[model samples]
Target: MSNSYFQSDLLSEFDRLHQQVASLFGGFPYSVRSDRYGAFPQLNVGSTDDTVEIVAFVPGVQADQLNVSIDKGVLTISGERAPAFGKDEGDESRRYRQERFTGAFRRIIELPAAADPDKVSARYVNGCLTISVGKAEASKPRAITVQ
Candidate 1:
């Protein structure tokens, strides 16, 4: 029998097929992260016994430029960020590199079923937008006593 140099493993073939299937479906798989890669205003989500906390890192954006709202258990954050360097009509300069995100952006977050839409609050400070959604009374932890 001749020795074969190339070998294809079952696991490797499965991984390759998965990638092809994912790409065929628009390259987006269901995940907890943002819908698209490199989404602006990266967020950190956490929870406490009383509330669900969401923090969005948005530097160089003013508080007045942000809009936060909740509808049907979905939290939406929309805002516009102006360019750092304003363009002048008379000055003609070409930008070599622009990394910062500018213009309108909207981020949607799905809240848990226990999240009370009526009890929601948001505040923006130090370029960070913090949103808190109170959990339903029924969802709160309680001590049970044996009768």
Candidate 2:
């Protein structure tokens, strides 16, 4: 009979609808959605006064196997990792547990508006890929002139 009661009922109804939709779709979660959040090659992005710094945690992948590129203000990181178990393994060899991820993976990162595509550099060292994109001169912060 109170306003708070009505709000609570409405919120519960929305929650029930969400559960029903998730069940209908076989209980898919938002975090696993590739379009929403990239699932491979975890990335850390930051920005300084003049440059945007990006670090991708990608182990077991060599520099030759990885590729980094920027196009239309989007940075793409792609690569492949070979399977730990090789075909040479005999039938006696059994894989009781396999947790490592293998095969090809690609992740697209939308760069900020200030990122300059032409002034970008990348390097892979110690299993980490670091990329730095210079910001546009107009986008960099400047001290205002005081009258």
Q: Candidate 2 residues 67-118, lDDT tens each?
A: 9988888888899977767563444577778777788987777778888999
Output the worst ten-in-a-row residue range by lDDT, candidate 2. Answer: 27-36
lDDT of 1: 0.80
Model 1 clash tally, residue pairs? 0
| Local distance difference test values of all predictions, in order | 0.80, 0.78
TM-score of model number 1: 0.75
Off by over 4 Å in 1: 1-35, 86-91
